[model samples]
Target: MNGEVLVGILGGVGPAAGLVLHQEILRNTLNDGTDQGHLDVVHISRSSDMAARPAYLAQLEAGETTADDDHNAIENPAYGMARSLSMLVLAAEARSARLIVGVPCNTFHASPIWDTFAALVAAEHADHVTLLHMLDEAVAMIGRLAPHATTIGVMSTTGSRRARIFHDRLEPAGYTVVQVPDHVQDALNDSIYNTEWGIKSTSPSIHPRAVQNFQSYAKLLAHMGAQVAILGCTEIPLALTGSEIYGMLLVDPMVALARAMVRSAAPAKLVPLDIKLPRDVHLGKPKRTLSVRSDSVDLTDACETLR
Candidate 1:
């Protein structure tokens, strides 16, 4: 439980998600109200080099893995992610000798991407690095927050939904998962993929259209009798940064991963489970148009503001 374990945040999976995870880690770490008491964290965001995860998955689904065509030859996004993460592990070994890393992007955690990334990391750096599984962390949080919950709803990108990320994990744990129908899912996809106002493009400043779209999706999940909803997509939380939606509790995987990182590195430093750090609650503007710099926002200060 050495607090000195270097925590690594893999960015570029939507830069906003990594930033939010970093804030959550800092907010959930127990410090003596001093900068020196905080855990050492390294955030690596190499977005430009990484391919779009959804695009890669879609192509893979269409049987496009062979190198016969240049388009099919595009490297898997996981390779870039693993390469960056391996560099972080090397740096961590040089510094603290121990590391725990978290990737904030949900789509990246889908099997098609995550399996390769994990194997590559484990092949070389497994001895020194512990990669926290974001989905498992979220599911564990659901169990803690709602021990008796039966049906779970998931809000994720089209790629993640197609990958059955949440369903694979939750179903085996005795919980039923409810996802949007294909047509409704298309609207959900638009909320995150529409170039003009999608959460990926407009994060830290959600558009009214994005907000309204997610709201309607949450209502649909509620009507489907979901007892709780998992904001499976990292960007979805940016739009719906609340603990509940339409009476069902919402779970943020980024927060869950952050907490797990703290626990893995320094158990004693982990914040109490009951004192949940509100996710991205510091947006200064009204809900209709949330515009604020996430980098400058402190979750502790935001928690006080909420209180």
Candidate 2:
């Protein structure tokens, strides 16, 4: 793979997280002056059917883990989660993606949905379209940068907690996971659900409550002597900064996935950018959100010139 390739995103599992992943991918790509567009990005956002994500989580939290039980009144286990994921995989495949990166962390956290994606890939026999595991990338990054970090604060959905997503992966590596208190967890969920930074939320910018919500949790983690907090959920970074948290480090798995993709690219294909960097681009906050649910949402179509 020394040539340019099309990368697809199995996105809109929740619209908010998908936008961040899409933005990070473009922000980190090789930008040359000759080409106005950065890279070949094919985005496939699931239809309204992907709302099963929050529904599945609600079921798990309500103690209905059994397959026969209804998920959040959706009347099925995983609430059509597996089917929705399969559909997205098919859509991504239709776009001829060389590599497919899924944006939602909760979708990957759900073992059934994850397994469905894996099986679909095997069935398609499309080795040209590669799927990268976000969890594996995050854990590997943690080992590399903070091997000695024992206490990691995890901010994710209730579904991920029950599945022991980050804890299961980190514990085997000799790290202890620190959990947020019930009150903070409630506020965390509130920030995501009732505020601007959550899935499909259309707030113009990060809301004050959202910032307060994440700041309070980060401050609490610092009090508990947490070395770093892992933004395990894709929506988590929408509220909390992905890089740092009140002197403590914040590990974003989505960001880890994006960087891994960049690093994995061939040197010849990874051309050097010849653009002047803008100070405002560094100082600005993420104000954009992809609220669309079409088959493909191309952010590059609206990408601005380097200032």
Candidate 3:
């Protein structure tokens, strides 16, 4: 790539979402006998904490009244989203990136919030910084992939449980949305918030029961006339990676987003950029003494040096 591209991820909506974005970026870049061809990412992982807001919203949607303190403890999705957009604009300006992308598929909060976020980026008027939204890309891709399909089921978080977010955008293109029932919706929320997406889990296995729950839910939607099922939440894809859930074509929003990024960035060679770590190293956390190496060198020599 002639010009450097900086991907601004408003992550931390959940750790799983952030990790998925990173993995997608890595998957897009093709190794071309070079060190760096993958798009540079300036990821802000703190936003994942905003997931609490959605969980709170789910309770309210369920007709349960919550205390102000409980509400206030969670980050306002609107404010968190705005902050994330601002961060992306600032990063683009500072880094002189050619493009900026935000990966928030659960479009709850408010519609005007997205407009405001767009306006903020437009005000910067950075010629090279093209702001991209994952939801729009995903919707468009699904349309092209399943043109004849009528009803599509969406599996997203409680925050984005509203049908308008997907239907408002997809209906005009001649598609209808079918979502999980309220009870099943609650189960999905628990699976993600308590087990996969949340930090409280002691044993975070894939949880076969969760998969069966989702599969059963998908079948129900299919029985209700949904031609395809869209895995709206980022965490759902990780859970349903290899399993074959019958009764509808399964579509993953994250996978759609990745395909869009690759198609959009075509002709720009992608190369793997591996950041070596100790066997037990964890990402984004500090470690003890360490060595850094680029992709262009021989690891054998580096190992000898370390020895």
Candidate 4:
């Protein structure tokens, strides 16, 4: 563990979501081990129940915390997610983690969740625990990867769409967002909740049908003039890794967030040149920089690919 920094993952909102983010963080932490050894990460694989909309609403509407209330069972989505976040930070702190990053993007983009997280973290007053709006990172990526695009495609959870995370974030910045049509949106919902793209699906690999359906939407969005698609939900990108749809680059918020983790937490000596990302991003070691595009993406060619 690096004495100066420790990064924590707030995952398991979906079974695979946190784990995939954990692996990505792990691989980035590989290559040149740090003096402190591998980058330390605390992962709390939360129960899917925590993200259950119906139960969460039932609990929220039931009102006011009681001694009997189990946060894990009855928490509002945001509250439960925030509760997990704080606990992980506490764990990371014990290990001398100077920074903590929440993953799966949904927790950050969801309504009241972001608001609640802000309120909760403020109460803690720990500057070391870090949280960035994934929407903002996605926007920055669009500016670089599809600089001229006036409209971008977005496919995410029903809750995220209702919250308007993409529209609210993008429209204000002078960009138009192309929302998936209802039928396309239904397909998306199944891919995330009912199919292999879903956390409930056990296997890490997305099924061919799910992949094919996802690409169909990509093609549709492209025909609609959306040049880039933002995998707004953290779960979406996990399926699309190494698969670029109709040549449209995907702006994965997790990847951007991971890049942020490297820049903010990794020790200065280990970071090496921005373009020449050192192998051991955490531990103090030197190896050839893996070449990925320098633009906001610091990932290597083998990892962060557009195709």
lDDT agreement with native, every candidate:
0.78, 0.59, 0.57, 0.60
Q: By lDDT, who's the top model here?
A: 1
Task: Choose 3 or 4, whichever is better by lDDT.
Answer: 4
* For model 2, the run of ten residues with the poorest summed lDDT: 298-307
Considering lDDT, where higher is better, how would the candidates rank from best to worst? 1, 4, 2, 3
Give the true-structure RMSD of model 3.
Answer: 14.1
Give candidate 1 regions above 4 Å deviation.
1-3, 66-71, 275-307
Q: Per-residue lDDT for 88-118 in model 2, tens only?
A: 5555456644554444455455565566556
lDDT of 1 at 187: 78
lDDT, candidate 3, 1-307, per-residue tens: 2465666667766655666766766665674645565666777766554546455455555656544346544433545655665666677667555655666445532343455456655765446556666767667756665566788788776667753566666678778787766766786767666745331241224555555555556666655677777777766654554312444666666655655565555546533223343332211111111122112212343233323
Regions of candidate 2 where Cα sits further than 4 Å from its true position: 1-4, 34-37, 57-97, 195-204, 267-307
Ordering by TM-score: 1, 4, 2, 3
- Relative to the true structure, candidate 1 reaches a TM of 0.85
Number of colliding residue pairs in each model: 0, 0, 7, 4
lDDT of 4 by residue, 199-271 (tens): 2362455555555555566666666667667777665654554424555656677666655565566644233
Question: For every model shown, what is its TM-score relative to the native structure?
Answer: 0.85, 0.72, 0.70, 0.73
